[model samples]
Target: MSASLREEMELIEKHEEILGERAELLEQMESRREQLKLQRKQQVKEGEAARRRNATLLQDLQKIEDCLRGRQLPPPTILALETKYWASVEESIPAWEHFLQGKGPHPTDGPGQPSRRAKQQLKTHKETTKKTTNDQGLPPRPKPRTAR
Candidate 1:
């Protein structure tokens, strides 16, 4: 071939190589996008399932709260078990004494305290119970007196 023709052929070969690389890269990008889409769909499904489970748990908790509201006292067995559990916990953790007294960090004020969301939920529950009690024309439950 002539010199000019040979140079043009080399240029064309370089262009073809570049085009092939670009096409491969595009295919890879498309594959990655598909994978990401599938992952996002799976995450959404998992999130929905988790939300369903949480709702069911909340309903169960509400039922338990309703049952407890009607009863003035816990069963004797439960009371004894609770007393023993607390005694055991106190014995197991020496710092619990300091926490109970005014000497150290309060249990309800530190990391062990409920989260903001939990506090809000408790407030909502209290409001709901008050509303229900008022609607039913029943006397509101008295707050438990705490020991000094």
Candidate 2:
């Protein structure tokens, strides 16, 4: 009976040690669970931020699309404006060409009429210079000989 009692005491001690190990394991498992929860919460927050950023970007895109839609120009009005612009350009071509040819009013003409010389200069500017040799009628001056 005494031997059986000793065996029972040793069994109780072993069970207590196993219970202590189980408690430690439970603590580790709880700590791991808490850590995972925190990580999940952080990921959720980041996901929410990303989702909000995407929503804002989508809204900005929609606004740009709206502005573009509002600013859409019809083809006919653009064509008409282009035609008027070309007509004005056609009216301006001669003046631009004349200005380039130096025959238009000088940039320094000031508030008064152009000078007569300025007008002559415009005419002379268009002509080529002529080179001429004239023979004086019947007189060739004798060359003065060098003294010996």
Candidate 3:
């Protein structure tokens, strides 16, 4: 073959290789664009769901506030229960105060403060201790002075 013709064939081959590489790179760019589009759609869906949940929560809170505003006082049943609960608590205060002041027998099982079971045990112990002292002919212990 002639020298110029050989040089033209080599140039044509180089051009074909460059076109192939360009096509491959364009394909990769198109794929990446599609992936980003899907990600954006997913994010939009999640944001809409979050907004819907927030609106629902706000509506529930508003309903609760409206209900509270409609009633100045609780029902009679609730009031009675609350009164009874407070009376019971008031009745127990003297014993709790004595226990807290270290004048009564301490609970044996727990640390720092007493649990409900420990308080019950303490009450039982106080009763038994009183009975035993009296039965043994020991003089009754002096009562601890109270602020009340």
Candidate 1, residues 49-86, lDDT tens digits: the string is 99999999999999999998988997999999999999
Query: Model 1's lDDT to the true fold?
Result: 0.87
Reference-based lDDT, residue 123, model 3: 100
lDDT of 2 at 18: 100
The best candidate in terms of lDDT? 3
Question: Which wins on lDDT, candidate 2 or candidate 3?
Answer: 3
lDDT of model 1, residue 35: 100
Off by over 4 Å in 2: 73-148
Write the residue-wise lDDT of candidate 2 on 58-110 in tens digits.
Answer: 99999999999999577998989999999999987886788679787644455
Go through the candidates in order and give each one's C-alpha lDDT: 0.87, 0.84, 0.88
Which residue pairs in candidate 3 collide? none
Candidate 3 wrong stretches, greater than 4 Å: 1-7, 73-148
Candidate 3 — worst ten consecutive residues by lDDT sum? Answer: 103-112
Model 3: per-residue Cα lDDT over 29-130, one tens digit each: 999999999999999999999999999999999999999999789899999999999999998788778878977744333466776667888999999999
Question: Residue 105 of model 3: what lDDT?
Answer: 41
